[model samples]
Target: MISAKLLRVLAPKIARRYSSECAKDGFTVTVIGAAGGVGQPLSLLLKLNPAISELRLHDLVDVPGVTADLSHVETSCKMVFFTGTDHSEAICGADVVVVPAGVPRKPGMSRSDLFTTNAQVVYDFAVVMAKTNPGAIAIIITNPVNSVVPVVCEVLQKAGKLDPRKILGCSTLDSVRANVFLGEATNTDPKNAYVPVVGGHSGPTIIPLWSRSNPKLCLTNKKLASLTKRVQEAGTQVVKAKEGKGSATLSTAYAASRLTYCVLRAMKGETNIVESCYVASDIYPGLKYLATPLLLGKNGVEKNLGLGTINDEEKKLFCGAVEELQKDIKTGEEFVKSKNVK
Candidate 1:
């Protein structure tokens, strides 16, 4: 018998309660590259999501054992796996197709350094997904999001099924990091911190809008600069910390899972569910894609809540990021274009 106090202590946090908004059926989510470091844990997290009906895992490598492992977990979500060269069947009727299928950043590598390998990796997956599940929300978590997003969009365009709104580059990890950091620095509950990170998700391109955060802080200029750098280079920081072993697998999985639920909530008719994503948006002057907090609903991106209350320093961050983001986008687009010509 559990004590009432213990039960009170054991109750889930508010973020987890978002899953309560759904108890519906037939909401399948397909995770590509499901046997990889991020994919395995992300699949496990989504397995625990009561909102997800059927959880499908797809990868080049055989993942039946991984599926078997998760199937034994005491969760209502059904586990299914698709392995070795055929991914379309797994993605066919999924409500959301999440792509975390790409090479990761090593200690000396920048996210752009991953482009040549991951570009084709993501493009191939997006080709199948674009043809198979055009209506489903495509949440991209492949690195160099600024680039791969545009590459996926090109696939959809070529397929004649382009819906810019549904193609989202998963940038929620930036927001997750920003919120927790702000919460710790200001002694506020991280859940309530709610930081909106904008720009692209790479190096100088990732911008955490500290001035716009809820329950704001009055940090000195030095503190603000440090915090900004921390958020921007957090992935590199993780790679270094791990001594080149891995890059942000666990936290990336958790953040991607969080966004997955947000998409699910919208599909199940929940309102006011917002999360940041890098998408094909003309929000900025010179960039085609940018990460902004979007109000998610049934059709995906019900409304894009524009960046709010940016300070001068934040503006400088955006300016510095534009050229890099543009180049990344071009690299992705050119990769697909070159393939098409070949």
Candidate 2:
């Protein structure tokens, strides 16, 4: 009884309403390497989220204990533990798979140094996820993320299921650090401050675009350089303060959890969701990947926001960062190629 003209206009709105209703039911999220420092806290935070109806924790060891610990928390979400060789079991129905596995960086060790060991660890896990949860979003938070992410992409590609949009490097920590440091410099509330940190996650390669800071505060070249250095070395600062016990586990866990939540909210088709992450892209033309502001939606990275603008001094830093990042990207790609040959 509906006219063709009216049907065309109303059909899209009706479909959108249906999709929104379906998203309210939430999705299953799996945390691989869920027993580590970052993983435990990240899981606890996710369990507290009403948007997650099911949570699965997987690790090579101690998952039962971690599961037991989290299961006690009174929440409607069902929690499951899968340990040892059952990694795939955890990922079976995952809407998102978060990886915070691999060894933590020791004092005097660079992120690149963690590459050899973490690459193998990440690749092994990526293989399982690619097979079991091929469509699920993969969030890589392992140390040396600049490389481990590439390893993940390569493994998924080999499995014939590479979707760049679904694979994201959790560079939110870098963004978090920039926000705090900028907040301190400008005497503003860190909670409300938003700073865009682009490029890779390690030293020299990390770039905090202060020019794009919201509620723009004028900063001199000297002050800007000092702030930039502080943001880049914030991780090392945490390591030194911890005095060789472990690297920035607690803060990193907090930052990773925030990112996981952002992805979950976006997948629920929540409007106006935006966050920055290191993702596979041609955004910078010659670069293999770059961390830039990302618009999140049901499909993960919906759009790669271009770098706004940079002053002369910032431009110089950007070029230097791109140069160093090239080495990191090459190292990751080469490691995967070498392993596949063997």
After aligning candidate 2 to the native by TM-score, how far in Å is the CA of 15 from where it should be? 27
Error of 2 at 118 (Å): 0.6
lDDT of 1: 0.85
Clashes of each: 0, 0
Alpha-carbon deviation at 76 in model 1, angstroms: 1.5
lDDT of 2 by residue, 188-263 (tens): 9987898888888888778888888975869888988898999889889888988999888888887877888888
lDDT, residue 70, candidate 2: 82
- lDDT at 195, model 2: 88
TM-score per prediction, in order, is: 0.94, 0.91
lDDT of 2 at 221: 82
Q: Residues 308-332, candidate 1: write the lDDT tens digits.
A: 7788999998888889888988988
lDDT for every model?
0.85, 0.82
Which regions in candidate 1 have their CA more than 4 angstroms from the true location?
A: 1-15
Query: Which residue pairs clash within candidate 2?
Result: none
